[model samples]
Target: MVDSTLPLFDEMPPAGQVAAFKAAFDAWLAEQRGSGSLRQDGSVAVYEDMWEAFAAWCLSQSPVVTLSSLDLADLQAFQSARFGRKSSDLSLTPRYALRLMRLIDRVLRHHASRTEAVANPAAADWIAANPEIRYADAAHADPLPEYLSVSEARQLIAFLSSARPRPGKSRDAQAPLTWQEVRNRASVGLQLGAGLTPGDVRALTLDSPVSQGSRVRERPWKLQVPGNGNSPARETPVAPWAAELLQHWLVVRTEAGIAGTFLFPSTRTGKQWQKPSQYECAKRVLEEAGADSREGGSFRLRHTFALRQLRRGTSPQQVAGWLGIEPSKMKRYERVLPGVIEVV
Candidate 1:
């Protein structure tokens, strides 16, 4: 029998039934809290707060209510009252409404699983109907990369290799090369030219191979190296421009006498640099070089490398092996990169 005294619902039950239900519900909630199923602290506080707000809104409808006693119609009415109606200042979109409804349903199902009575099927049906509510298409908004054109790539290399164009005044010689400035430029080449991830760049140690050659090899930190999903180990090649920057950085590093195992050490800590440090350095370099920060970061450089390979008519299987992604994933990049996708 249902309890009428429960403010949320009109049905009333005997005192014994109400006492037994309350005891079981409290015991079940305690179990969930102990099992780490119902989050009360940490990052889950925000979610807890949101659920409590929904509960408060439901309770505002009537004072004599309990969660277990609430039916689908009452819950739906609460949802409609809070989210369906629009105010002058702001209105809840279908997406936001779905988000809250999902959370509410999740808690309700969890609670129902602990009890004898089954949860309402109508709420479940409503959830099934509102699946895949996307607020925006972020994928289409991503812009094309502003990479170094083939001609520009060659020009930049020549500029770096060449001496003064006209032998200007002493002003040129007096310019100070801040350690950070040099590292930033090297970051671009290492990522764009070498196809190294930001983590790979950070984990670089002084002992890393920097010999004068196009085929310089270095094993980045284990974390930075890509796992073959479930396969054996493999080696990825270094790009020519990546090799050039690496070669130049080696000369500067040797002169500085920086003795840490880490190729990039934090000036403050004298410790090997981490991923965030390397990312910031790379961002500065890309911004300075007028490259789009969104498109020319380490991942974009890797994308460019894969795209170039695909454009050259390399098979998807071969490109997949090089990029350490599944073959099907490689096809997406090929299709996305302009000029690489050729429909037969």
Candidate 2:
């Protein structure tokens, strides 16, 4: 087996060159880790694994051992070795290989800039020349995102509302819940009501604002506020139905003795909120109600609400603010997906 610690320098390098290269790599890695750029996650692990494979293949081909010793010929050979190999096919995609190379290039470039090493130019050039190339568009069919029509949305809600609860007295019992009828309606209402995301809904605590007569407030939606990061905060208005459903949920909360910060607690636990679980439950409800639209799922509720707001003459800027999206991103929603909505 190849020595994992071997540097990529020629002839295994002199003791001094090996020490210098190791020192440079150590320092660069420290900086990346400390600066929060390099996450110690599966992505980084996969990149490292590919790099090890490439390094091993290079060592097998040439006497070189340190990154600095790698040349254009070695780069080409590494790509060739990786291309369509069994390991590559089974463990990695071409995209994965390309990503690994780019990550290696980034590390090398960082090291080169700091160390003023000779490898910088070649590494940079290789990265530029063989960047994980891609076709402009996907080769596979691009099924336009499935979306719900207004009528379909209405039907979905009606179906979910009418679904009988499972054979039990518990409200949480399995029932034909429709997004339109309950979860989807509730989701759309919350989004329209308070401009909340699936995350925000999960994060909503009892302390979140509500109406006595006709008012609502909460910390900005999860995606809107800057607390998670440096992103700016935005406050958006909620639609009437969202406000009502939220109010209704509060009533259910009281009966369930659901006391906590989370606004949308699990019907089972009634004490904690989980976005994925709730979404899945919502999907189940929709499926049971037979509310599948051309868009195929409840994601269209969000789309429908946004499109409705736009068709009502809401400006892109306003919609963007409401949805907690950058205005540039709002341009895509200016026109609703075909069959997803009708003009009021």
Candidate 3:
């Protein structure tokens, strides 16, 4: 629904107030596309989609829907209606609801400014009705992010690079095959170095020439990592250390008589790795590397990757786009950024 290409008011009669405002909203979003504030990641589309969904919902509820006509009751209805929407599975998370409301807030504010209206009474009413509409602080939340220090990450990566089941632990079900250790190292490197999830790593195809032919002894560079779900793929710069480790494993992966579509395949057979098997491998790797005790499963690496970015002064907006994290989820990492908190 929202037509980004159409004019807000051109060729419209003066009586078309609601259509004018809706057009203005879409036009504003179109302009936002060029701004650094708007993410190039698919999230921009998702944001648009939320607004469109709200618009469609409003149309269903009332024939003449306008920003000024909307009140606190209407907004509440929209929030409650998510329970009935098939996309959200009837369980609209608080965080999702907040972003939708925020975008509603943003659009009304912009609409007022564009129209030179005295004030946005509807926006005011919604704000007053829900004072706690924003995301919570991650710094003080339960289950704080588990991150490894730079040195600790290095230690873990080192262990993973050489990790294989000891002869004594051969009976253990969690032990990775010796050759599979190499694959695990490469897979973990993406998470530790570039913030990719296991799914993101599993989604990678090794048949490409860059992956199949890149040399560690030669020029090292970045690669585009595909994202899962609505998240867009991002180009991740490969650090020499991570590149060396990944490339080493690639060679070993090839030599092990494993040839499959995936970058990391099952050790039992060179085929796609199922989700459960992926988790088992991750648990085994973390246990061996002393990172098994982290509260969040596998997600900690993603958190660590995000934390590292914030620590190094990367903008939260850019980092969010790079990591495919939603607006609410980024708050957890925002409070930990430098200058926001004290370090003892």
Steric collisions counted per model: 14, 25, 0
Model 2 per-residue lDDT tens digits across residues 102-183: 6667767777788676554444444433323321123532223234555665665455333333234565655534322453
Tens digits of lDDT, candidate 1, 197-242: 5655665555554343333344222112333233223335556555
After superposition on all C-alphas, the RMSD of every candidate to the true structure, in Å, is: 19.0, 17.4, 17.8
The residue-by-residue lDDT of candidate 3 on 154-258, one tens digit each, is 777778655433335542555555777667766777677667776777777663214433554442345566666646776665555666666667666777778
Among these predicted structures, which one has the highest lDDT? 3
Task: Give candidate 3 regions above 4 Å deviation.
Answer: 1-144, 163-177, 207-220, 267-269, 326-329, 338-344
Candidate 1 RMSD to the real structure: 19.0
lDDT of 1 at 191: 57
| Model number with the top TM-score | 3
Order the candidate numbers by lDDT, best to worst. 3, 2, 1
If scored against the real structure, what TM-score would every candidate get? Answer: 0.46, 0.46, 0.50
Native-structure RMSD, model 3: 17.8
User: Which wins on TM-score, candidate 1 or candidate 3?
Assistant: 3
- TM-score, candidate 1, is 0.46
